[model samples]
Target: MAHFPMNHPARPIYRVLSGLIGLYILMFGVWGVVLTAGESLFARESNWALGLRTNLAFSIASVIFGAFLIIGASRRTNLGHYMNLTAGIVFLVTSILMMSLLQTEANFLNFSMSTVIVSMIFGLVLLGTGLYDKVGPPELAEAERRSRDKQISEANTP
Candidate 1:
């Protein structure tokens, strides 16, 4: 039960988002591999124009990436924030590229418009979480200031 740095305003949000996204990706990879039986997983016809080719290799890659996100979130470090940001960018870009290559049986993420939209939304959310501290609310800064003051006073009392 590791705790994030209390002073960072968006630490909690980043941790939660990263963990959720990582879980989703890990499950998705498992689904892809199990459902397709490793065959035709990478085939374009399997889904659509989505950049994700759900073969054994891709599935393993997804799991690895998901694990990275999970570990980052658990660690609650700057590295975690950057990892989330990077994952968001990658997902968004891949989905967009898939959309651009759409065909009659082609679309992003399982040949569905909904999946594409969802991916983009998730991307934006991750990006926002990652950048939240850059212009954090005044209240958060004040709270941190007060907390530090309390710690200093407590230390002096001893």
Candidate 2:
């Protein structure tokens, strides 16, 4: 990862934004899992044991998914960005699947909302930065090409 000083061009804002988004994803994930596992409104059933098991499974899954997103976001490589995008898609898919099969649609909705909001913010950042890293900045590319063209022109002039 390129280290940028506080005064390094536009680096400060971008890094801070990325870090905040990372924190959001991690925090939301941790909270959602905890809510599911706790003796809360949604983790209710005639059979307390069953309810505990169901909520515990959900809690574990949510935490795992959230952790994956956080790790992916922390990586600065193009592969890392793609991994984060995949994690976002996983959140979307899990939300839809849970809603379709589970009776607790409301909790699922909350899960969907938080995952999507955090995932999108982080995913958008990943995509924007990945593109910038891959194709080089437009002005820089143009200048490099011009320099190369000038060299070629001089080489053939003789």
Candidate 3:
């Protein structure tokens, strides 16, 4: 028997969430790109210890991931299916890590709040898209139906 996979369209919620997540990624990427390019203005005493190299590394990573995320989300590629969930988790984890990285009296406490809010936004998008995922379950259902048909046919055969 020939085998063919079924086509599945992403749910509306997933598309919306993916786009929003893409935009969020773009925002961070732009922020990083700007900071890296214009380091002199945003430079702080604390950042001195972090060094230029570290900042550049992080900025580049942000830009790549953000741009890819936007593309993946817009394209709705297979890889994007995983990236969405992973990005959401990553943002949440990073937000927590950032909170701990800061000293209690750190001047950038507001940054923490912003991170938390952004993290929550990603979390919500992930939750919504994941819950509304349209592709995965249908395939499982199709496979199950085929299995049931095979079992029935086997039982009927003498």
Estimate TM-scores for all models: 0.64, 0.43, 0.57
Weakest lDDT window of 10 consecutive positions for candidate 1: 44-53
TM-score of 1: 0.64
Candidate 1 structure lDDT: 0.62
Q: Name the candidate that leads on TM-score.
A: 1
Q: Summarize candidate 3's per-residue lDDT along 27-75 as a digit string, tens digits.
A: 6656655555655432333221112212334555656766766765665
- What lDDT tens digits, residue by residue, belong to model 1 across residues 1-158? 32223336556766787688778777766666665564554444453113444545456566787787778677644676677678789879966876675564443233345556756876887665656423335687678668778988999995
lDDT of 2 by residue, 1-158 (tens): 44211122443344445455555544544554555555553453321221222344454554565555456546544444455445545545654564454445455333333334444555566444333332235576567667768978999997
Scored by lDDT, the top model is 1
Reference-based TM-score, model 3 = 0.57
lDDT of 3 at 90: 74
